[model samples]
Target: MKVGLVWFGDDLRSADQNILWRAMQEVDFLVCLYCMEPHHQRPSRYATQGMSENRRRFLQQGLNGLNATLAKVGQTLFVSSMDADTSLNLILNEVPISHLYRNHHGGWDEQQTLKRIENQYPDVRIQIDHGLSLFTPSQLPFNLTGLPESFSKFRRLVENVDSTTPLPSLHKLPPAPSFNIHNIMPWQHQITDNHSAFTGGEEAAMDQLSDYFSTNLPNQYKAMRNELDGWENSTKLSPWLAQGSLSARQIKASLDVYERDHGASESTYWIYFELLWREYFHWYATRYGKQLFLPGGLTGKQTQGSYYAERFRKWSQGNTPYPIVNACMKQLNETGFMSNRGRQIVASCLIYELGIDWRYGAAYFEEQLIDYNVGSNWGNWQYIAGVGADPRGGRHFNLEKQTAQYDPNQNFTHKWQGQVYDSQLDSVDAADWPIYPTSSN
Candidate 1:
């Protein structure tokens, strides 16, 4: 019987997955695999690990759901902490694999890994499906090399182009090949807090999407998206979207339904607009390759800021003098989530006010954000640091002005600042305190 393997990377869900669906159709028997790379646990240049506790927890939840879904269809997801190359080597040795399928991620490292795998195993038939974006590269008006430099230009070209309809969720799978694979690694699970707003899994993603659309949230999204805090302010679909538990095309399909039922408005259109921004970055990363991660971004312009360890530590800990920046950072540190407005505010403060390297800030966000996307995270940092496709050199947000506009009454600031300040005080001694005013004070 023909044997095939499906390697789950960022694409974790069974729904609307072309790679999974195609693999099921083409093979008599299939083995589903996931490799938990060690790189995720190691510290990055920014002095932060790739996956934070919150992100790890969320990922584990998603994996559980994926595995359960597969089991219902008489298949089991084989997970390993071994590197992709080594894990695939072991699997290929055990089974006479006829074909391998995986989603095409645009990161330079991902591309390099695929190349290395193909070189190592020339006999195995490998098929790559571009499942990450709302529109495939072939569907785009321009090729990767010819992608527009700015988002507006890119949006104009593809705005009218139809997004591919999401494939229905797979309910059946080919029988798993008989194999005694005992070396699977344990999933690192964390106990999530009861009050946590986000949960991982395709079910959770759909539920959030359903709940958000059930109300007038999408109607007011454009006006209230910039609010620093509140669940109702924005569609919280990003974390799932980042992990591929939610597909961009799936969201677009729902948006079309909402517009047909309720009249289309700027708010509804803005949702598609943001998704286009994500699509732009995905292609941009593909075009630029490793340059997206370099100090000099796509433009090859060197960042003016230098790395300061102390400043970076303070920034990560949300101890900056700017209360607005602190609030945003603290929110990220605690929840592994932050509003888009909060991200921009804190990112600008790190690059412009703190004079720290933009790459470090980008790397830190990759470590902290549960919703982290390599293209969006690095591309945005490059934009803010004046190294990417921004028409303006860079964004420099005035902290006072931002605080006044977003938190006029200091409601958000006071909420986060008190927690951070109290935590800082707990580590200090009386000698460090200024009970009596010193001349310096």
Candidate 2:
């Protein structure tokens, strides 16, 4: 029997998954696959692990959710540890596959794997689709080659495009599918002893989305989105979005429905606007690939310095002596999440105040964040570090000024001060946190 194998990458969700849906249509029997790539969890030249325990746990939850959903439809996601090329070769040999389908992952490793699959199995029909962003290249105002450098320019050109761009429909799985359960190989690398906060699966992601919009949370998002005090202010849908457990289009569609049935407000519109911002970054990364991850960034003067493991450790551990920045940094270290405001403050402190390398900061985020999207994380870091697309770069957040503006009452500072580090900045006589250099991604 001709069978289809659906490859899962960072895109872990079953819903709105073009590859899964396409596989269902092409083969009478099908299977889904995910490989825990070793490189993803290992440290790069930056001397930090690629992912943290909190992120791993969150992904596990999402994966579990995806597996449960698939089981209900009489199919299963077979997860293994072999690299994509080796795993695909083994699966193709065992499953009698006629086609291989997957979503387009823009990472360098993923691109290389796709090439290997095509060259190795020239006979197999491999279908790839774009479902990660709200605006795919075809639907954009210009080809990626001609895409604008500034986000404002890009947003202005593509903001009003029709939502219905013929997205692939989610398909029902067959009652039973040909299997290779026993043939699964052991993971090539050592699984980390640490666990992550978010689980990797579809059901958990759907649960998160349901909770975010099913209540008054969406209504309160705009008001509290900038608050670093808690998680209630924002939808916190990024981790799901990053892993493809949820699509930007799906979230946008739901927002439209929510606004129509409920009343449209600034909060609702703002969330959609941010999603578009995220969509902009995705396209931005695609339009300029390796440059986004570079030290000089897409737009900066490249500077290299010693990787002072000590200062970086203090910063990452949230003991950097700056109250607001430390509090946000502590939150990220503990929970694998920080508010957007928090991200800006801490990242600014790292690149500008600490005079640390921007690459170290970027890699640190890549290692810790559950919602670590190469495009968004690196793009924002580069922008903040004065390297990326920002016309004017390097945001050196004044701790006193920021605390006065965002935590005027000092409640936020007081609450988190002793928890992570001494309330060093709380002292009136302390020098305003030092600003070291001009920088961005």
Candidate 2 lDDT by residue in tens digits, 1-441: 668878887777766776766667668887678887777777788868777888777766666767766776677777776677778888887777788888776665677789998998899989888877786677887877887777788778877886653244354785445555454632222233344445555666677788777887777788888888766878878888898888887788788778888888988878977987888788777777788777887764766434556567777777777778777777788778888998888888887777888878888888989889888888888888878877776567787788778988867766766245644322232476443333310
Candidate 2 matches the true fold with a TM-score of 0.87
lDDT (Cα, 0-100) at 381 in candidate 2: 86
Q: Per-residue error at 283 for model 1, in Å?
A: 1.0
How do the residues 1-441 of candidate 1 rate in per-residue lDDT, one tens digit apiece?
789999888788888898878877899999888888888889876678678988888888888777877777777888887777778888888899989998888888878878887988899899998888989878988878898988889999999999999999888889878876556543434346545688888889899988888888899999999999998888999999998889999899999999999989999999999999999898888899999988888778766888766667778888867788888888999999999999999999999987988999999999989999989989999988889989898899998899889999999988898225423312234676423222211
- Each prediction's RMSD over C-alphas, in Å, is 4.5, 5.7
* Model 1 poorest ten-residue lDDT run: 418-427
Residue 211 lDDT in model 1?
88
Top-scoring candidate (lDDT): 1
Model 1: per-residue Cα lDDT at residue 416: 90
